[model samples]
Target chain A: MIRKWSIALLGWGAILGLLAPMLHTIWVSFSPDSFLTPPTNVWSVKWYLAYFGDRRWIHATSQSLLIAGMAALLAVAASAPAAWSLGKLTVARQRLLSILLLLPALIPPAALGFGLLPLVYFTGLWGTSLGLVLVHATVGLPIAFLIIRTCLPAKLGELEAAAAGLGANRWEVLRRVTLPLLTPVLLAAGIAVFVLSLNESLVSIFLATPTNETLPAVIWPQLRYSPSPMVAVASCVTALLGMIGMLIVIGILGYQRGRLIAKNTTAINS
Target chain B: MQRISSWLPVFASVALVCGVVMAPLLLLLRVSLYEPATGRGFYTPGTFTFANYAIFADSHVLGIAGFTVLCGVAVATMVLAIAYPLGLFLCSLPPRAQSIAVGLILVPKTAGLLAMLFGLQRWLPRGMLATIIAEVYLVLPYSVIVIYIQLLNLDPTLRDAARGLGASPWQVFRRVTLPLSLPGIRLAFQFGLMWGLGAFLGPLFLGGPSETTLAVELHRQAFEYGRWPLAATEAVGLLIVVSIAAWGVPTVAQLRKVAHS
Candidate 1:
């Protein structure tokens, strides 16, 4: 019907509008000129080469990877146990606790950055990787919690109870039963946490120092005023890492869903 | 013993929340009451005062809070408007098509906020318009997902039954679909508003000085001016306002549910 077509038209129009900036970023990053401008008469990898040729950009990239990795590990460690225990709660309790865990995300992250700026200085971790890692973990924990919690099987208690009834002790149940079941969920949460921390800008603006500066911190200043292709190149690399992270998430989630469907169909057939 | 043992694992999450999040927040609250340094440190380390909050009483500071709230509301409304059609359309598609639609839509958000904003800063014009547009873009993905998930949960049988009963499509939507998805739409609006309040990157990266929200002001005070006490004041103020605004959210949605039924 005409209505359906019009609605589709509107939806697609909105999607295109939303995508405009990212597309522009990609286009601008490839600008053949040393300085960035629109109406790209040509395309070149000069910026990409420039990024590779520069020591600071490469150092920033490695620093970002190291920080993101450590943060993700810490986040998943905290998130997995929390998610499993939350799944054991009654629905009402579970909902309330999840919201409590999510409170860090709901508030302005500027608040966290402001708070951490002084705390880190006091703790003697100011501008250190240790400081950024701890802060990133705190910020990424809510998302990591949500990811693992959602991906967890609904019958978590039933499964754990079944294991315990079969003579597994608490530690045994956790080690032998709970962790295996949680592997994929933990993986998903870990990657999600890593990607978020990698592209993180807000807290990094406050925390990053000369030695510990991440790609976003490096990209931040260069983005101001008249940006060059080098800035675009850095942005493009960060953007690409984000897309790669999304693909990994989709693959893991899809595989999990596919397995669940297969199990359901097999049960029906048998 | 069993109940106590069962609670042991939950303690890790509780510890992380309390230790990493709440402790620093509490510390910030304490720091807000400190005497700001005139000559030496981030603040006078131990001296306590209410002077930072006194600055908040000034009309200039109050204007920033008011402007921030207005921006949040504007971004929320605009994001919801754009998101509704996409949510409806995505939910209408078949499973594979639905996934494709979602995947396509996530491209901007998945590219990450910093990169996307860098692009937006270049493409969009400056000032409040650019800030709003970028915030809307930053928020649209989440809003659409909220609405789509809500709409997907509706019973298609109700729509078919409405058509069978001789209601027009518009009537069916107004009578059935609209009523059912009102909760989702409300949730989307609230979610957008919460995120808009937290719209630090968009405004920071793209907006002019006149577009200074409370979040940006907090950043300016802390980093730019080295006024930790003033920044902590802005942070605490932002938290109180968001909590107060959010209190009315569930009630409005609940009232809508009653009215529709």
Candidate 2:
């Protein structure tokens, strides 16, 4: 009974702790006064109007979406071949290569971003939207690889071998056998990359100037100065966007899981 | 298996992508050697000097790096401490309850880190304590996810047999469970440390002036000061430190794995 109570407490503590930040942001969003002042008034969306109506916020939001969308596409495209190679091929030094590819994910973005600033600035690509997209792609690559790699079929090698054993060539096997199995994971990976790229601030900070500022960069100024409730409004919107992206990914995963079960059942019957 | 060159095209493309991605970072090493007067002319063939590195070594950069590693260690220790008991508790829960529990832990993680700062900043006392609290909270879910997976992957029969032989719960945990789970624990610890070190926006917003982490310092150097060389040197130094830690962690983890095996 004591153990059960403790576990229950742990679960509740985690949930409450997580909720604390979200709730506070929501509360402050509607507050009549700024920092350290007691909030009055029932819930209001004035800050939402201030954030949505602001030209800067609108521009930042659109830039964020464009950068995030392009980054996701490029990252997923870059990683798909690597992930497929990792899942389908058996070769020497594979593990080392995979680890090397994963280094960007392991390193701190601040470190990487700082390193990139000089090089990027010199290349005439600094402060450009496309440069920001490339940086985002680099950051998102390992995550994209990991997510797609996970959902790869366990029997991939067997299927490839069978296809080869029959009269089918490599291209035929790839087009027919492998691509179908890999599509869901690719979508999931894209979604994860999209969400992460969208919320990204650190590298974007290095890559962005005032004219090219991402939402987080713009929102950051609000935090340092007289923080308007609009900061909270932006934070809430950002959180909502991430959650929506995650839900879509999870929904796809659920569908993939169902198909996996059906595949297993069919195999058992055969 | 027959050696297949069929995948070479794919491998080469991946390598090319990684190479392009790495170009800017690789340039940092070159910039670190360039003269400070060559500011925006970073690519110009200038006399190489150690002035940038010397500057970084003199500034609070060294102090920032020390604090970063220290905080990372502290947070990693805290996470392992919390995760072990919680992982055990998770194992004891029913499957449905376990899923729900895991989901609740992960929800905050997916909500993006901005929510994490905004949420915790509201109720908590600010500065290092709040920063630590947020870092611990952010890292906990990941640790739990890793540990829970480890626990589930473990052979439960050993615990069952130990209990069957009249061993107490404490003995089973101490002798069988804990000893067997060292590899997983090591993995969880490494992840926690890495996450703590990489944590940017958390330290950027939540940290006090006294707790200036290397990550935040890197941001200041580049954005605020436009001290590219200083920032690049510091970033490179941080990479080296983290690389050593990253490299050392897996070796230790593998040794533990071998011992356990």
Candidate 3:
């Protein structure tokens, strides 16, 4: 009993540590005073108001959202078919291909940023949202692939074969069977990719120009040079979006798991 | 003919991955070898030299690499220590509790690194300690998630049988749980180590001048000092180090599995 209590305490402590930064940011954003000094008055939304009043911050936020949205869509599109292919391949081939796909994530972001600079310049995509989207999609592909692949039913091939035996053509089988089954996982993967791309700073810092600064890029200079409650407000906004994204992902995953459990129970009963 | 069509998506994705991902990396490697010209742009064309790599002999560069590696190892060790117990704790919880715990832990991870670092800078003192603390916070969720999944997938019968055989709870954990989770632990350690080695923001925001890491130095060299070849060299060096650490752990784990089998 004592051991269990201590373990629970440890878990709570870890959670508190994880939440400290986010909570502090939210607190300071409303404190209506300097971070260095305590608030003498009631909480206010002055900092949040300040964040919205700044056109640069608004531009950064919209840019980040647009880029992240495009990246997520691209990652899902690229990885879904690849994941389907991987599921059909031999185990050895699948492992090799998966690793190859994951290579973008394994390397240091700085290397990728430095390496892509010349390519981006030569392709005339430097400082463009399209370039960042493409890079972010590549970075997000691994996670998206993993999620989609995991959600793919192990008996997908068998199901396809069965559908074929029922006189369904390939396109019919895919459209009527495979695509429907994949929608939930695809949504989950898309959300995960969005969160990853939104939070990605290292690569964005290299790729972002003054005209296309991302939210994190905007905050980076502020954090480095000038610290203020405005930074806290920006942090709060990013954190809020991230948490909402994660919560939605969790809900989708839970629903998927529930359906799987129900199917398994029915299979056992029959 | 139908079979050929089915392979089209696969081929297209492979082509996309090669064009978008592999090509740029190849570019990075080529650019690293080119000679850098001062007062010219990021790189000078039509020249190659070993002189760029020779700059690693500078004690400052060596010091930064050594410090970065040391910090990586330190962060990896600390994260594993903290995450191991937390992983076990999370695994022991009810499903609802486990999910809640995981969601809370993932906030720091999903929240932008700069945002977290900003908050941390205000909360913690600047130095090596602050960098480590922030990095640990950044990486703890990953380690815990990996280990927690490992624990969840473990065969309950193994623990039950061990207990039935008169093994104490501690012994069961040591002899069964720990050994079984070793692969997950190893993976977490590698990830933590790599994140630490690639740490730019942690040291940038939370660290003092003296705590300058290899990543930060690479950035400074390339952008601040206009030394592209030197920065590329450092980037390549970092890549090699991280690749070894990333690949090394898994290879060792596979070897151990083979030996055990």
Per-model DockQ:
0.64, 0.50, 0.61
C-alpha lDDT values of all predictions = 0.81, 0.74, 0.82
- Name model 3 segments beyond 4 Å from true: A34-40, A260-270, B1-7, B250-261
Estimate the TM-score of every prediction.
0.93, 0.88, 0.94
Show the lowest summed lDDT stretch of 10 residues, model 1 chain A.
Answer: A260-269
Q: Which window of ten consecutive residues has the lowest lDDT sum in model 3 chain B?
A: B5-14
What does DockQ come to for candidate 3? Answer: 0.61
For each candidate, how many residue pairs have backbone atoms clashing (under 3 Å)? 0, 1, 0
Off by over 4 Å in 1: A163-177, A260-270, B253-261
Quick one: best TM-score, which candidate?
A: 3
Question: What TM-score number comes out for model 2?
Answer: 0.88
Q: What does candidate 2's lDDT look like per residue over B198-219, in tens digits?
A: 6676676677787788778867
Ten-residue region with minimum lDDT total, candidate 2 chain A: A32-41
* lDDT tens digits, residue span B30-136, model 3: 87898887666877888987888887798988999998898889989999998888888888889998888888888778754555676798889899899888878
Encode model 2's per-residue lDDT on A191-241: one tens digit a residue. Answer: 888888877876776667977788877777566454557777787787778
Model 1 is docked with a DockQ of 0.64
Inter-residue clash pairs, candidate 3: none
Q: Order the candidate numbers by TM-score, best to worst.
A: 3, 1, 2
